[model samples]
Target: MATHASAEKRNRQRIKRTARNRAAKSELRTTLKKARNSVKTSAQDASTATVTAQSQLDRAASRGVIPKERASRLKARLAKSLHKATAKLAAAS
Candidate 1:
């Protein structure tokens, strides 16, 4: 319940931004999940999947939706997971 004129405009801006914000966040999560799934499904696909995930993370960082360092950290962790999974697969085979 903003009574001021400026507050009304701010509310409008918030409304418009909400959808885009949600979309961006959702896209980021979906990309990350897809990458993780791809890695888990095929040891051979890990490299390509990691690459795709890195791209998605970089895009998000560049757009200011996420910090570059945070994106890099996530990428690093994902790659590490992929590596560990691949190593396990190799050991098992």
Candidate 2:
């Protein structure tokens, strides 16, 4: 659908960028899911998962696969959940 030479180049760039972005986002999703699941398993696991989630979120934002604000929100939620899980575990003993 690109008529001009520049437009054709842009279209190719877009295709390549799309593939790269999709892979980045998919990796972020997988990491986040693992983090959340770990929270339900144990306090140590939750702490590890939260740290991993924050790292992935920062990477996603840095790479432009996700917005900074969105990444911050996810990091906050993960931290909150981790705190709650840790507290619950502590209270149990």
Candidate 3:
């Protein structure tokens, strides 16, 4: 479909970038899900998962896969959930 040589080059670049971005986004989602699941399991696991998910989110934001504020908001929510889970565990014990 690309007529010009420059257009063909750009098309190739777009395809590669799409794959890379998709992989990064998928990784981010997986990390986030793990963090959320860990919250329901245990505080220690939740803490580790939160850190990993936060790091992945930051990387995704820096790479332009997600917006900075969006990443920050998600991180905040994760932290809040982690805190609540930990507090509930502490109160129980």
Best by lDDT: 3
List ranges where model 2 is wrong by over 4 Å: none
Across 1-93, the per-residue lDDT of candidate 2 in tens digits comes to 889999999999999999999999898899899999999887787777789889989988998899999999999999999889889988998
The local distance difference test score of model 2 is 0.91
TM-score of each: 0.78, 0.95, 0.97
Per-candidate clashes come to 0, 0, 0
Question: For candidate 1, lDDT tens digit of each residue in 1-93?
Answer: 999999999999998778776798798898888888888888888788788889888988898778899999999999899989889998999
The model with the greatest TM-score is: 3
Per-residue CA lDDT of model 3 for 1-93, tens digit only, reads: 999999999999999999999999998998899999999897888998999999999999999999999999999999999999999999999
lDDT of all the models against the reference? 0.88, 0.91, 0.95
The predicted structure with the larger lDDT, 1 or 3, is 3
Candidate 3 deviates by what RMSD?
Answer: 0.6
- Among all windows of ten consecutive residues in candidate 1, which has the lowest summed lDDT? 16-25
